[model samples]
Target chain A: MRRRTPAESPSKLSDVARLAGVSLSTVSNVLNHPTRVAASTRTRVEAAISELGFTPNRNARALVVGTTDSIGLVVFDLKNSLFVDIARGAQRRARGRGYSLQVGSSDSDVEQQAEHLRFFDAAQVSGLILAPMHDAPESVDRLRSHGRPVVIVNHDPAEANVCRVLVDNEQAGFLAVRHLIECGARRLGIVAGRRDLQPVELRVEGAHRAARESAVPVEVVEYPVDGLEPEYGDRMGSRLAALDRDERPDAVLAVTDMLAMTIISRLTAQGIRVPDDIRVMGCDHNTAAWGGAIPLSSVSLRGEALGEHAVDLLLDEIDDPAGHVHETITIGPSLHIRESTVGRPTATPPA
Target chain B: MRRRTPAESPSKLSDVARLAGVSLSTVSNVLNHPTRVAASTRTRVEAAISELGFTPNRNARALVVGTTDSIGLVVFDLKNSLFVDIARGAQRRARGRGYSLQVGSSDSDVEQQAEHLRFFDAAQVSGLILAPMHDAPESVDRLRSHGRPVVIVNHDPAEANVCRVLVDNEQAGFLAVRHLIECGARRLGIVAGRRDLQPVELRVEGAHRAARESAVPVEVVEYPVDGLEPEYGDRMGSRLAALDRDERPDAVLAVTDMLAMTIISRLTAQGIRVPDDIRVMGCDHNTAAWGGAIPLSSVSLRGEALGEHAVDLLLDEIDDPAGHVHETITIGPSLHIRESTVGRPTATPPA
Candidate 1:
């Protein structure tokens, strides 16, 4: 059980393989995929590793293999469940492909994003998946210039030469508004935050298109907010509730499920029924939608799918950098119908 | 920008300093804390870096400095907002201390947790903060044996010799049940999930203590579930709704906010008015409580504070490993009263 001192040089995989009288790949299989190695051979390798005190040095291995079995994921915010879902998806895919995913939250700060990128670069991760914010193209260029495989997730970068995966937000907005219209709505309201954001802009565009394509004449009103906090939704809800019954929009679609949940809460608190009076819908069918008192109807952005696709693209580039072609993959959004838009059934409860 | 080929050895800080006719520290300062170095010297160092195609090798730097400028955090579940809050707090603290935080989600898997620990070990992180699950003590031992400074978070380990930070779950349970009694409850029910979990057991114990301390005779019912999923909450809510008025508990306390939210949603759907028919409360005052249709009343675990404290302990260990004593710091929980426990205010809407 003696441990190596700082002054002593560490044993290598080669030393363990030589002592165990096994091939290098056999020793590697015993270390990484133990089930792939036979019991007797694995025991012999283990005894040799114990005798040699061999701890695999990832950096040295990376130098030999040209890459490490790790991928770095940089996201704007981890507080948002969407990013967590994406990380989970990416982690599962990476693990399946014999790679580990390391996550760093930029917290929406440009400096933090840059620092994470630098750290990942220094770590020499096999590849990187960035859900970027604020001056992303420059960051991507910097990473690419360093000969690192990069995959942009949850965003369509301005540069088309890099691999990217994003949810079709415009289609998400279209599906949400179209669903509301189908539920017999003439007046529609779109609750939006930060108009300059690409996803927000695309969703707004889709909403407008939905309004324009309506068979019956429909009025679409945009309620813009500074940000997507629940307080903003509460303010909007209070304002909506203050309006006369006839003046209020018959249907509303918040840009995100969080805003929609807050709005529903506020409206319900003020004695305003959800679907009975004004139907409501949201995008990013996040966990909040299901856990809310009124199950929220929302457009699914498919965060996990976006994450998995980003990793797929990253791995492809990592495996064959010479023949890699950068591509932008867009995942289509789907609609989820729930009690918020459609009132609960009057039938007896299930036994 | 011409890049060096893989065949060429990366430039060292000493080489950059020599090229710039400056000290090594000056080159280091320019790369790290740039404001500390003079602008003229920084420009010269930048020119030297560009001319030499310098890329700092983190592994080599770690070998020189004995550690990397990073901390590793392994959490049971990043999907839970509580863990995310902890990570956010730890990241901010680490960044302020000139360290980067790398996070990995175990998703309640033991092998995943072990993988993260191994990855961090390979990366030579300065320290580690682990929110462990399944054989945590052995895992912590394995990490400590590797000469890594470790701080356990969210879970108090079996080995008291290890540094750990956790919420006072027993006190959390007691606070929740005490609040219910103060709100005039004669019959109380504790809605718990996964009885084997230490936190759940502690909270239940605290609930019993609260009932014993009540002046009036109170009946405490323990309603145990297989797990904490929303569907389990729904099932429990239905069971409660089906009970006779005289048999039903006047107040119920769920182990987590997520369960409380789902219960509220299910109860309201079944014409069982919360607080009016049965006052309900929860522990872990997570974000779901605030975002729910009925703002939930619960006990706050102070996850961010837990995270921050974990980092502080980790840093202390890293700085003075020889003098560091193993300590278990437990943060007290507080109650948040909202519309769920007490019905919405009767006051008229504000102008």
Candidate 2:
């Protein structure tokens, strides 16, 4: 630390006024409303600020206000590709709204997710968005009663009237199954993510609807896995193979592309040709599903839109907590059809 | 914005001072330095604050010291997987240091990067870390001339004597080729990322060194594709197969694991098997790479460690700007040899 000279010992408005060649009242005006000061005067006062290397004590400022200026984002699993996109969307939207986002991974642990909220609350963040692994009843109550704007992302819980930003996971499942039926797939299987999320349950319901609507026998087999990883896909592929000849689904629909990619790879290991033998499809047009023998056809959720909407809702809540309303916005899982879903034995030319 | 009620305004310090039966300075001390004031007085002061929703203006505090409690991180390309990993690493590291990171993507344009820099400077970010796309000499000079702490993340211009955080990409390239050679991969083809990055050039150099050292008749073919997307992998696969069995290399080295996954998929489509028809490998053990028909042996660059080290270096620079210390830490591409490189080729399994 630099030693302070006797001249710098006044330690108040009068000392700063003397150093900046301005009156104490002018210094007060500069601190309160900088736009009211002249450019030349502003430059001089700013120079004095840099030379002194002073830090206006936040503790003193905190005496007047309750908290600071930052935002927190809580994601359940860092290991999932879906959350990577969600985090990106949130970061971009938060940047535009004039607050920095602090991201943390829960790794599907309820305790870790709650811990993040407590840490952010202690630091006094402006707002928060959490994608919980399970329905966090106690934690949700604490956050809501704590008097801050909190928007839930990707997943909906058992709570009443909380703000949510999510995509139509059911529509994604419907689209995948409908495409498989078009490809002459008489039977289908599913590689799913964690069952606790609302999207997971909703998607399965949509796929069941498509199968019943088509009057075909659909084999809904859940890949026995913990979190959504590639290993789950590999396990799901073998599950399909182990079934009876009539029970083996001609098409397998994954809740996530990561799972689909794994199923495709492992299925290929067992000498099954995609589409020609059994067609495998997935949701989330993640990069991993593409660039293969037959690029997997899947759904694309508008990531940036989900992020932008979350920010907009949070800002509205912060501006007027009582008068502001809570709402839910469900975006898309737009289809990006590729070669994997086409049920045909082909000798197509390489591009 | 909501209108403040008369009841909320009464919790002001002057009102609190009158209500608590104390002076204005005493109320201020109770808020600023709780220990300095009497506990009885502090309780009265705290009761008054909770009644009011007063948020102290950070701008007012910054006017006195000219410092914002945030850091700036501007990356070259948001679409690139490597850059995304770097940004995540930087953000994680920056958070541990109690600093919020402000991120911006330049989209491979020098003008946009500079514009982002100017905006960040005006916003008064505490410091900046940039991966500049276009070398804006004037802008770089101006940013450096200012007292803000700056560190360039990826690219080194050499003249600036700036702080940097990077891995030895060229050595990684050389090692990939050497590993292939050790496993009897004589014929070689390389798929590289954008040439603008110094790592690409370095990797090619490493490949050349290994071929030179082994004295094996190493024939190399370079595919200069667009950004390191999986599409590039698909395109490269056919190019490799277009050659006669004698001309086609027995191995393929992709700059990224994403590309490697695509290459394996496309090769399988063409009825050519991995490790049997050709050994496939890549850099960066990204999770998706492992989901393929064959597991690619990859050079794992410990992303979390890279993040932690960069923050340490940046903080050191911030603490002692005039120390003239140059510390260049070289990390690794630790090779993970898996199924794609050495396993026996099995029959193509079902999809």
Best by TM-score: 1
lDDT of 1 by residue, A22-90 (tens): 765566557555896799999999999899887643344444554438899999888777888899988
Docking class of 1: incorrect
lDDT, candidate 2, B227-272, per-residue tens: 8777888888877767788888898888888888888878877867
List, residue by residue over A286-313, the lDDT tens digit for candidate 2. Answer: 7645434445778877665566667656
User: What lDDT does each candidate get?
Assistant: 0.79, 0.66
| Model 1 misplacement above 4 A | A1-68, A145-147, A230-250, A261-280, A286-296, A323-325, A337-351, B1-68, B145-147, B230-248, B258-279, B286-296, B323-327, B338-351
Clashing pairs in 1: none
Instruction: Show the lowest summed lDDT stretch of 10 residues, model 2 chain B.
Output: B54-63
Model 1 clashing-pair count: 0
TM-score (all chains, Cα) for each model: 0.73, 0.58
TM-score of 1: 0.73
Q: For all the candidates, what are their Cα RMSDs to the real structure? A: 14.1, 19.9
lDDT of 2 at B85: 65
DockQ of every model listed?
0.15, 0.07
Docking class of 2: incorrect
Candidate 1, residues B14-120, lDDT tens digits: the string is 56767899764456457655896799999999999899887654344444554438889999888777788889988886775557898989887787787787778
